[model samples]
Structures are given as structure tokens and as C-alpha cells.
Target chain A: MIRTAVIVFPGSNCDRDMKVAMEAVTGSPVAMVWHGDAEVPACDVMVLPGGFSYGDYLRCGAMAAKSPIMRDVIAKAKAGTPLLGVCNGFQVLLETGLLPGALMRNASLKFICRDVHMTCDNNETFFTNCYRKGEVVTIPIAHHDGNYFASDDDVARLEGDGRVVFRYSDAVGNATPEANPNGSVANIAGISDATGRIVGMMPHPERLFEKALGGTDGRRVFESALFSVTEATT
Target chain B: MKAHIKITLKPGVLDPQGKAIEHALGSLGFNGVDEVRQGKFIEVELAEMDEASARAAVEQMCEKLLANTVIENYAYELVA
Candidate 1:
């Protein structure tokens, strides 16, 4: 059985939800690693779930990014372990330098809470392989600081390298100004690093995985990543 | 030694809060307030005796934790 670990800081409110979601799909126990711990422990995939880590002090994920366990997380990331960071987790990954770009205050300066449509930009990566290219998926986004910022050089590099995985779009999957919920550059809802092993995104895919809640479009993110890893290993 | 650090977003970066403040000031009939930008002020006390070393330490802190240099710039002054 493969293991997945979910890192939990003091103020993390989504760790349990993520754990339940992963367990339901993977049929294995997911470890909830504490922020104060020095080691992340060995896991196939490590998750940094969304929440107000460190009570959103200084910055959304700043203090939590410097927490003790991050040293291990960074090491593992460098050694090629796949990582998925959601919402606040995305901010933390940016702060940790595992992923590029900073998530600033939303352009509206107000907390956005609603479902947003996103399109799969690249289905070749381990995380999005389950969805066809340009597939539209509905995911809930809840945050005040989901605006992504990056230097022009890096943006060009990311685009050229095919690292942008998801972009906000309309119901028909058209990228437009009105479709951009938080003013992210190019309507990027999620991005993968150059290696495509790590992903950070602002949407809450775990929150609406079951159709009973609203939609099951979010399930393929985990399923596809699983397919990629298990197939590669075999 | 005491270090006072100020962190501000780069000029090109959008400051929504600052913009809101500017709008509020305009509504209050304040004249000639062309632009307003906001930043953070952080004060830290350290026991380093040497000024050069204190400045170096604070600069390192700014790079590592005090400020995110990617979008924000930070400057520190040593006091007393």
C-alpha cells in the first residue's frame, strides 16, 4: 500500500478533510504530520492542505513555511518526491521556493467564496493526466490572497516550459477577464514546477470530490497522479 | 541592538489596500494625494554588539524571513 502524508500546522483546518479524502480513495491510512516535527516521514505523495496556518500571521503561509518540518519537505522535494499543495498549501509552497510565484491579496481586496471553472492546460503531467487537454472542471475557491505574482522572466520560462497546468475559465472553458476570479496572471488556477512532480493551486479540489456535495470533477486530479506514479514504478 | 524593518511591495506591484486608502482619502476631500502605498514595519531586538554584524544579521533575516524580496523590498535601520 502506498503512503501519503498530510502536513498539519497549528492553524490548519483542512488536514482532517484531506486525510479522509485520501483515505477514501487510496484505501490506506494517511499520516497527519505535525508542523513542529523535524521529519516529514517517508511517503509516496506529501500534501500541504489548505487553512490559515499560523493564524495567517505576517502572511498567509509565511510563518508556517519556516516551521521545523519544512526543512524535510524541501529536502524531499529536491529528491523528487511528488507534492500537492492546495489553497494555503499553494502559498506555502511558493514561500518555500518549491513552486514559483507569490500569492498576493486578491485584486478585489475581498475574500472570494464560490465555485470557479478551470480548464486543464496540460494533461501530460502526473497530476492532470486523467483529464483531457482543455477539459473544464468545477472547483470551489475560498481565499482572500489567491492572486499569483511572478516575474516576467519566470512567467515566460513557465509558459515555454509547459508548466502551467490549470487556468480559470468560463463554463465553456474560455479564458476571459470575467472568468478570472482572482486576477491571476493568464488566469492560472494551478501550476506545476519545471519537473512536473510538484503542483500548487488555489482551488479546493478535496472539498467537492463527491457528486453528492456538488461535483466529482476534482477526483481525477488524485486519480491521474496515482496512475502516473504507479504506472511509472511498475 | 534594535532593528526596525520596513517592507513594501515593489512599485509595479498592485496595492489594493493602498488604493482603497487613496479612494477613502479622495472621498474625504484631501487634495493632491496622488498615490498611497502601504507596507509593514517590524521591530526586532538583538544582542549583537557590533554594528556591522548587527546590520549583516538583520539583512540576512530580511532575506530569509522578515520580507519576501520577490514582491516586497525591505530596509532596516539599527537603533540604540
Candidate 2:
């Protein structure tokens, strides 16, 4: 059985969604870990769900990144545990230095909440193995600071390493300027660490996992992680 | 001691809010505006009495939490 842990920070509104989605997919109870805890339970996957953590003080995820639980999360991620950070969780990952780059205010300077098309740039990672590379999927994004920025060299390196997991794209899979939702560098919507075990993305997969909610496109993300973990263990 | 901190986005990093403010000024008939880059100002009260220690602490704070060095540059001044 695949076990999952969902870190819950104060003001994190999407923790419940993560818990529900993981349970629904894995058929196992997920542990809801408080941000104050120093250690996380043994689990196959860890998820940092979306929300206004620590009221998004100082910066979007600056305050929460320093939480006690993050130290353990960092250690676990470094040890090859699958870690997925969505939305505000992505901000926390960047602030914690687990992921390179910074999320700045959107070019439009507006809180955008809508469905956007993104092409799966790489599907070999633990978090995206279920997706076919270059497949276009629609996911909902709701944030004001989802514009991803990195140094020119870093962007080139990420692209070269095939670590750019997803890119904003049109319905037909063309990554056009008009398809860019938040002015992210090179139309990047999500990225992974060099090892591909740690992934951070601005889109919330848990929010769109069920067809009743909207669509099932996001379910494959969790399925992919679970499949990867199960494959590694077996 | 108080540490006055100024955090500004690094040169070449896009600042959408600053650009919006610049456009607003243009609409208000203010001419000759070159560009606008927005930043943050923070005042932190330090319990340390020694000037050197306070300065060091403030610098660490800027590096660790107050400012994200990835896209921002921070400068600070200590005042009695």
C-alpha cells in the first residue's frame, strides 16, 4: 500500500483537498502532518498543498518555508522521497532553496483564477510518469504571484536537463505568448529538481482530481507518483 | 537599535506592480517619467546593543528571511 503525507501549514486551505485526493487514489489513509511537527511519518510520498500559508506574510511562502516541518521535508526530499509541491507549496519550495527561481507578481498584476492549458514538457519524473510527453492538459490556476522567474543560465540548465516538467501552452500544444498565463520564463508552468523526485508547480492537481469537481486530468499526477513509488519498491 | 532595510528587485527582473504604477502616473499627465521599480521597506528592532553584532544580525536576517536574494537585493542601515 502506498502511504502519503500531506503537510498542513497554518492558513493552508487545500490540505483537505490533498488528503481526499490521495486517499481516493491510493486507497490508503493519508497522514495530515502539522507544520509545527519536527518529523514526518514514514510515507512514500509527501505533498505540500496550495493555500495562503502563514497568511503569505513577508513573501508568498517565506514564513512557512522556515517552519519546523520543512527541515525534515528537505532532508526527506534529498534522500529521494517523492515530494510534490503545488501552488503556495511551490513558493515554499523556492523559498526553501529546494527549487531554483522565484515567483513574482503576474505581469498583469492581477489574481487570475481560471483553467489554463499546459503541455507536459517531460513525463519521465516520479510526479509525471503517467503523462505522455507533449500532451496538453487543462488545469486551474488561482494565484497572484505565479509568474516564475529564474536566471537566464538557470532556465537554460533546467531546459537542458529536461527538468522543465510543464509549460504554458495553447489548446493545440503550441507554447505561445498569448497562452502564457503569468509571464513565466520560457512559459514554464512547473519544474523538478535535478533528480526529478522533488517537483514544484503552480497548478493545483488536487483541486481538479475528480470529474465531479471539473475534470480528471489532475488525477494522473497522483497516479503517476504512486505508480513510480510502487515500481521502485517492488 | 533599529535596522532599516530596503529590499529592491534586482536589475533586469520584471516588476509588474512598478510598471502599473508608472502607467498610472502617465495617465495622470505626469510626463518625463523614465521607469518605476517598486521595493519593500522594513524596520526591525534588534535587542543587541553592540553595533557590530546588530549589523551582523540584520544582515543575516536579510539573507535568511527578510529578503529573497534570488530576485531581490537588500541594503540596511542601523540607527541608534
Candidate 3:
């Protein structure tokens, strides 16, 4: 069985939703680990869900990054365990130094809540195995600090290494600057680390895992990631 | 002695609360408002004997909690 754990912080609002998505797609129970807990439950995948953790005080994910459970998450990521973070969770990953760059406030200085289009820039990554290269997918994003920013050199490094897993795209899969909601660098909406085991994005894929909830494409991400895990274990 | 650390977002970054204040000021007939930005001022006290220790302690505070190096920046002043 592919063990999964959804991390829950004090102010996390999407832990259950992420657990549900993992269960529905993986057909297995996902352990809900508390932030105060020092150890993460034994799981092959660790998910950091979205919410206003610590009321986003002192910066969105600053306080949560120092949580006890994050130490385990960081250790796991270093050991090549698959780690995924979404929305404020993404901010946590960056704050933990698991990923690069910071998620700044939206340029418009408003909370953006809408469906955004994304294109797969690299399909070979463990998290994106189910999506085709250049394929377009729409996921919902709701955040005040979703604007992704990195130094110009960092952007070049991500692009040169093909670490940018997804970019904001139009309906036709063409990257459109106008369609970008948060003014992220290079229209990037999602990215993986050098090893591809750590993936973080500002969009809430768990919220769109079901067609009834306005999406089904998001499920492919979990499915693909599970496939990678199952293949690795066998 | 106590120290006050003021943390502020960078210039290019957006500050909604600050913008709101600027708007309110403009509405109240305050003119020549070119820009407005918001920041946090945190007061911390230390009983160390030396200035070097005080500086080191404040730097530690900035890295460990007071400021998030990722997005926000911070500056400190000593009040004796």
C-alpha cells in the first residue's frame, strides 16, 4: 500500500480535503499528522495543505515552517521522499528551504480566487507523469500571497534545468502574460526541485480533484505520483 | 535597554493595508501623497553587558522570528 500523510497545522482549512483526494485517488487512508507532532506518520508521500496557517501572521508560512512536524518533512524531502505543497502550503515549503524563491503578495494587492490555466513544462517529473508534455490543465487558485518571485538568475536556473513543471497558460496552452493572476516570475505556476521529488504550486489541485467540484484533471497529478510510488516499491 | 525592530515589505512588493491608509488620507484632503508603505515595529529588551552581544542577539531574533527573509525585510534601532 502507498502510505500518504496530509499534514495539518493549527489553522489549516484543507487538510481533510487533501486527505479525501488522496484516499479517492490512491484507494488508501491518508494519515493526518498534526503540526505540533514531532514526527510525521510513516508515509511515502507528504502533503502540505492550504489555509491561513497562523492567520498568515509574520508572513504566510513563516510560523508554520518552524513547526515540529516540518522537521520530519524536511528530513524526508532530503531523503528523496515525495513532498507536495499547495497554496499557503507552498509558502511553507519555500520557507522551509525545501524549494526556492518566495511567494509574495499579489501585485494587485488583492486576494485572487479563480481558476487558472497551467501547462506542463516538464512531464518527466515524478509528480507530473500522467500529464503529457505541453498539456494544459486548469486549477483553482485562491490566495493573497500567490505571487511567485525569484531572482533573474534563479529563473534562468529553473528554466535551464527544466525544473519548472508548469507555467500559466491560456486555453490554447500558450503562455499569456495577461492571464497571470499573481504576476509570478516567467508565468510559473508550479515547479519541482532539482531531484523532482519536491513539488510546490500556488494552485489548489485537491480542490479540483473531482469533476463535480469543477475539475477532474487535477486527479491525474495524484494518480501519476502514485504510479511513480507503486513502480518504485515493486 | 530595549530595542525596536521594524520590519517592512520591500518597495516593489504590495502592501494592501498601507494602500488603504493612503486612500483614506487622500479622501481626507491630504495632498502630495506619492507613496505609502506599511511595516511592523516589535519591541525587544536585553540585559546584556556589551553592545556586540546586543547586536548579535538582535540578528538572531531577525533570522529566527522577527523577519522572514523570504519576502519581508527588517531593520532595528537600539533605544537606551
Candidate 4:
């Protein structure tokens, strides 16, 4: 069984959702880790769920990134544990310097909450192995600061390194300007680190992991992580 | 001692909030505004008596938490 841990911030609304998804996919009990806790339990995967941490004070994820739990989380991630960050969680990853780039306010200057189509840009990564490159999937994004930004050099390096895991795209898989819901640079919806073990994305896979919730498109993400861990263990 | 800090988005970064404010100003009959950019101002009360130490601490704070250097630039002045 794949052991999973979900880091719960003070304002995290999606922690339960992530726990439910992991349990459903991995058939294992998921650990709920408080942000104030100093140590993280041993687990195959760690997730930072979506929410307005620290009430979005100072900046999104800025305060939360400095929480006590993050010190260990950052260390574990650097030590090569699989880490996934979604929505505000992504912001935390950026603030922690685990992921390159910053999530600026939406170019439209509005909180966008809706389903968006994204094409899987890299299927070789542990987080994306369940997806086929160029496959378009529907996922919901709800945030005000989901516009990903990096310096020109950093953006170029990310593209060159095949770290861009998902790009906002149309139903037919064309990454057009109109298809970009948050005006993210290069229509990016998700990216991975150099190791491909850490991923930060603006969409909520936990929100749509089950068919009863709406669609099963998001299940593959969890399944992908489970598969990667299982393969490593076996 | 007090430290006054200003954080602004680096040039070339899209500032939709600032742009919206500019547009609102134009609609309100304010004309000839070339552009508008937005930033944040923060004041910190420091207990450090030494100016050099205070400056270093504030710089560290800005680099670590007060500002995200990825897309923002920070400037500060110390008032003793």
C-alpha cells in the first residue's frame, strides 16, 4: 500500500478532499499533518492541499511557507520524496523555493473558478506517467493568483528541461490564448522540478477524482503517484 | 529604530491591478496617464540599536519573507 501524507494548513479547505482521494486510490489510510507540526510521518507521497493559508495574508502562501512544518517538508522534498502541491499549495512550493517561479495575480485581476482543459506536456515524469503526452484533461482551477511567472531565462530553462508538465489547452489540445483561464505564462497549468518528483499545479485534482464528484479525470494523478511508489517499492 | 520598506514588481511583469486602476482613472476623466504600476509599502519596528545590524536584518527579512525576489524588487530606509 502507498503511504500518503497531506499537509494541512490553517486555512486548508481541501485537506480532507486530498485525504479521501489518496485513501480511495491507494486503499491506505492517509496521514493528516498539521502545518505547525515539526516532523512529518514516513510516507511515499506528501501533498500540500489548496486553500488560503494564513488567510492569504502578506501574499498567497508567503506566511504559510514559513510555518514550522515547511522546514521539514522542504528538507524531505530535497531528499527526493515525491511532493505534490495544488493551487495555493503551489504558491507555497514557490515561496519555499522548492519550485522555480512565482504565481502572480491573475492577469484578468479576478478570482477564476471553473473547469479548464490542459494538455499533458510530459508523460515520462512520475506524476504524469498515467497521462499520455498531448492528452487533454479537464480539471478545475479556483484561485486569484494562478498566473505563473518566471524570468525569461528561467522560463526558457524550464521549457528546455521538459519540466512543464501541463499546459492550459483547448478541448482539441491547442494551447490557445482564449483557452488560458488565468493568463499563465505559456499557458502553463503545472510544472515539475528537475527531479520530476516535485510538482506544483494550479488545478485541483482532488476535487474531481471520483465520477460522483463530476468526472474521473483527476483520478489518474493520484493513481500515477501510487504507481510510481509501487514501482519503486517492488 | 524603524525600517520603511517598499516592494514593487520588477519592470516587464504584468500588473493587472495597476492596469485596472489606470483604466478606472481614465474612465473618471483623468487623461494622459502613460502607465500605472502598483507596489506595497511596509514599516518595521526594529529593536536593534546598531544601524548596520538593523540594515542587515531587514535585508535578510526582505529576502526571506517580506518580498519575493523572483518578480519583485525591495528597497528600504532606516529611520533612527
| lDDT against the true structure, each candidate | 0.89, 0.93, 0.87, 0.93
TM-scores for candidates 1 onward, in order: 0.98, 0.98, 0.93, 0.99
Writing each residue's lDDT as its tens digit, candidate 4 over A1-234 gives 988889999998988999999899889999999999998999889999999999999899999999999999999999988999999999999999999999999998889999889999988777789998899999999999999999889899999999999999999999999999888999999999998999999999998999899998889999999999999989
> Candidate 3, B49: how far from true, in Å?
5.3
Query: Over the stretch A1-234, how does candidate 1's per-residue lDDT look in tens digits?
Result: 668999999989889988877777767789999999999888889999999999999988999899999999989988998899999999999999888889999999999999999998988876788999999999999999999989888788888998989999999999999999998988988999878889999998888878787888888877876787688889
Q: Give candidate 4's error at residue A130 in angstroms.
A: 0.7
Instruction: Quote model 2's TM-score for chain B.
Output: 0.95
What TM-score does model 1 score on chain A? 0.97
lDDT of 3 by residue, A1-234 (tens): 789988899899988899999899999889999999999877889999999899998888999999888988899889988999988889999888888888877877889998989998898887889999999999898999888987777889999999999898899888888878888888889889998889998888888999889888788879987999999989
Docking quality band of candidate 4, CAPRI definitions? high
Better of 1 and 3 by TM-score: 1
In candidate 3, which residue pairs clash? none
lDDT for A74 in candidate 1 is 87
The TM-score obtained by model 3 is 0.93
Ranking by DockQ: 4, 2, 1, 3
Clashing residue pairs in candidate 2 (N, C-alpha, C atoms within 3 angstroms): none
Arranged by TM-score with the best first, the candidates are: 4, 2, 1, 3
Model 4 spans with C-alpha error above 4 angstroms? none
State the DockQ, from 0 to 1, for candidate 1. Answer: 0.79
